[model samples]
Target: MDEIITRLQRIENLLEHLQAERVSKEFYSIAEVAQMVGRSEYTVREWCRHERVRGQKSRVGCGGTTEWRISHAELLRIQNEGPLPIAKRFG
Candidate 1:
């Protein structure tokens, strides 16, 4: 019983460490965020443009290129609360 308890504690510690390392990035691309939220890329893009969720947009190109990046913290927010109370997009 004691050995089983020690093994369970080790497993718990490993799980916690893995969870922390899972979100290593400060920001995530629209596609990545979509995968995390199980939503379409188009939907995530709209969320960024519509301020449903906070994101940083980049459009530095002659061809009018645009890309959105969401911070890990913002994604966590979205996970905790549905996208609402429109936030101002930045960058």
Candidate 2:
């Protein structure tokens, strides 16, 4: 009986820990998105580069270089329905 109570307590603690990792930011970097999606940073960058995920380049890097940022809404959309369609070019 004591062992069962201990196991349940441990599971509850683990669940709380996992729940604490919720997304609380409006925008996230490529690295953050990569970890959330279980993919590499390179792959996330590609998704932004190809317009496959509705990402935007923000001026938030060193040396005045821009970096890709994904919104929380887009991340949810991706987790629910995969990538967005490729945007049409106007050239």
Which candidate ranks first by TM-score, i.e. highest? 2
For model 1, residues 1-91, the per-residue Cα lDDT tens digits are: 9999999999999999999987669888999999989999999998888888899987756988878989989999988896766554442
Error of 2 at 39 (Å): 0.9
**Residue 34 shift from truth in candidate 1, angstroms:** 0.4
- In angstroms, give how far residue 3 of model 1 lies from its true place: 9.4
Each model's lDDT: 0.87, 0.87
Per-candidate count of clashing residue pairs (backbone under 3 Å): 0, 0
Q: Candidate 2's residue-wise lDDT over 23-59, tens digit each? A: 3899989999899888999988887888888999888
TM-scores, all candidates, are 0.64, 0.66
lDDT of 2 at 14: 96
Give, for candidate 1, the lowest lDDT window spanning 10 residues.
82-91
User: Which 10-residue window of candidate 2 scores lowest in summed lDDT?
Assistant: 82-91
